[model samples]
Target: MLKASSDAEALRSFLMGYQNTSLTYQTYLKELERLVLWCAHVQKISISDITSDDITAYQQFLMLPEPKALWCGNKRSKRLKSGEVNPDWRPFASELSPTSIKKTMSILDSFFNYLVQTQYLKGNPLSVNKRRKKRTQPQTIERWLEKTEINTVLEALSEMTEPQADAFSIIRAKYIIHTLFYTGLRLSELTNHRMGDFTLIEGAWYLKVIGKGEKPRNIVVVDEYLDALTEFRKAIDCPGLPAFNEKMPLIPMQDKLNPIKQRRIDQILKWTFEAGARRYETLANQEIEEGPKHLRRASKLRKASAHWLRHSYGTYLVKSGCPIEKVKTLMGHSDISTTMIYVHIATNDLLDSAQGLSLQEED
Candidate 1:
């Protein structure tokens, strides 16, 4: 429990206790600071002067940036020699993406709940039980690799040479990618997975994942990924660690001048780009030649971030004959609505179902 009279003090206390958790405490604290600063600016009052209305107004302002022409944050120049344009000047402010604003708002809501639970505040302004105006559903857009493009990436990875490439490391990275596609596990969950986490149920492989908010779920892994996993484990052959050398890291980076972390996983992705992965190059070229566009056009399919593999997996399964509920479970999504976004069923499939219904009616 926490007790603080003012917003700033309360924020300080809230952040103080969060240092130990693996969650992005620094990033989240910075966002909260931004909100507090904005609130102070608007009210022309000290941080301690903040009230429930201030929090409410701040949330509204976050969603709807000032309509009046305002300066954009500093923009980077493309060329090294080409110096920055008037660093002091701001470009026309663009509205924050709904997705971005929504994520921040979610943070605030959670913060407020924490404050209330800890007795720091009398009431929570963001409480959903309070009446509110209608809000639009969140935009559902995802970038995924096409089936052909996924195969191209796997093929590129498969053809890597030795000396420059270590069979054990490359295979582990490949298996991780395939497992993400087959299991749709979140990045954190994948990182936490041990060899022992996998189980063979009726000869099918399944991996357990601890998803968002600490909820546990199991994802199905196909035979292909299992075979890849087995090969990768055998190649590594590290001893003295339990559960497939659980004490030893599954995919130790060749560049391990330091400890293994998510950043290293990102570096693994950079290596993929070097290994004839064409996605990033295509995206960079397209971004320059083409104007602002949708995600599919803006980002290359193969060079997408690690999470995009999960998106590809979800989309493919839904596009196939898999039920939506089952896909949701495999993806470890708490909400059915989140799973709905990935389902892009073909018109032909829908049409076939309609025809089946018509046949039944005729009978």
Candidate 2:
């Protein structure tokens, strides 16, 4: 019943359906390409010919891709250039972690389901009952910045002098940091937003964003975020508040025409965090006795990324007595279980209560 004559043609047809969302399209393409290559070379079978046993073998293969010389390469090495495949490019950079293996299986499950739905496959090879019964491990969110650390980064951004960073750049960095912390938006959601997405409904402001899975949700805009927005707009020569249904990008580049890319956002956050780390390093040098403590703090800050701000937003909300349901809504999480992790993180102090209760704890 398969429509396509070749596996490559069928994959192209399947991928075409995801073209509307560039990120999803790229991710599916990458994962599927690896599967297709594995089938053609290793399994010596086409994608449609893959069976349940083959899927099980593929799962093992993902853990440690064999023939490392042919299947692994330097991370982010170019796979293609000027419309030609790069000979040195490999399917994987190295072995996948347990978490990564689970993710790959999930993607493959979805891919097989899609093919089944389209009649490209007689049945999904990943539909084994054991796989269906596998429970997803609870998500552990360990990466996030503390309130004081966030303030330190902001202070560092404020301290940048001319020739180091321009006035516009400093303001923009502050706005970006504040927005991420306050709104809890994913990187893609933030970059995809337009000025019109921020709307005043019944005398209150809200930002509408299309989150993961293309689901749209509205997030309340706090006063602090509004102030940051005002500063950023003023720096770009826009009104203090955006016009109704404004067509401008929420965060634009220096050109003020094109929306800022995710890479630029990463760079801005990295610079601010590194600047904050350098401040800690300076303090460590001045106070030799506290050097180790300060360096540890510096290391944490250096490891923080844009996603940390989002995690921080959720954690702070849960700590501040916001209802878990409300936090779930604000975060645009499809499942309340995902929001519950924040509660676990916020109440981690409870561990200290049990520490002192042991019968023979202190000798």
Candidate 3:
């Protein structure tokens, strides 16, 4: 067996040889780090020495990782230098859905295959058919927000009063939530937007977003959210409308002029929903008495983040009788089938509890 660091270095070198993009590289690097740590700590061997039995133990560990407190932490990367491994970071943030489990295992198989072809190891322990658990097609809840909860959250954002020092962060969070809800842009699309992306088309305003495959999509700016956008810009001392061809980040860090990372958006919404959850619980207890009736819906909102706004936008369109094809185009779905799910969400509320015919956790 090779030394742990040495084996990790070799695995990274192999993964890097593929010349993956930055996101791809980071993902593979983390998975390889997990395998290396498990080999060293649990199996008492190096990555190159792990067997099929070790793999099973690792799978079980992912299901119910003991010492949950240690396994969880802020999702930010603590170690940034390329090829450096952080063994302390847990591979699975929570229980892996069958879909995630299969993907992780498949990546390990690919890693071992690369090693075998390069003659770094005699055989691949993961090469044998381990029979990955079958996963079914997931139901498309799409993570929507109820209209009442949406209005409640928006009102909550409007009512927030904070100190001068914290004003920018609070205002920025409100703008992000409002813009996402109104435009139905994915979090990636929204974060990538530049100030110059906004334009006045003929009589109406529009915002250009780089969608799923780097395709540019123009979304119409609704009147209300555009007002919100204007207010946000003014608060930052920018013009009511952004300057022509401005280069500053859309949602900069605090007062710094750098675009907030994708993860930062989720972090902001986590607290936003947490606050909204409290308000939601207060409202529910006032109007209803049942323990489970509205709590289930409110609980889901509490767990939701920015993505829920996008889903709510789609569901709203579906409920408004927009043509399925139109919704597909607006949501940037290449396949119509992806858009069709929103229709089910709108029309099949009563049957949803028993829909999909198979049990599968959302990815």
Best by lDDT: 2
Q: Determine the C-alpha RMSD for candidate 2 after optimal superposition of all C-alphas.
A: 3.9
Strongest candidate by TM-score: 2
Give per-candidate clash totals: 0, 0, 0
State the lDDT of candidate 1 residue by residue for 1-363, as single tens digits: 656766667888878766764454654675686676576556676544556677667666766656333424433222345565455443223345556666677777778777878877666776642356477775355466666656656766887778767786677668667766777766666665565566566866677665665667877767677677677656666432225324333344443222356556666765664453454345446776533332343246434666777788888898887999998887877789888887554545788877755434543
Which ten-residue region of model 3 has the weakest summed lDDT? 17-26
Once fitted onto the true fold, the runs of candidate 2 whose alpha carbons sit more than 4 angstroms away are 21-23, 34-46, 49-101, 129-137, 351-363
Instruction: Evaluate residue 189 in candidate 1 and report its C-alpha lDDT on the 0 to 100 scale.
Output: 64
Off by over 4 Å in 1: 5-9, 12-97, 116-119, 122-139, 162-169, 201-203, 238-245, 253-259, 273-299, 347-363
The per-residue C-alpha lDDT of model 1 at residue 52 equals 62
lDDT of 1: 0.63
lDDT of each: 0.63, 0.84, 0.73
| TM-score of every prediction relative to native | 0.65, 0.82, 0.71
**TM-score order of candidates, top first:** 2, 3, 1
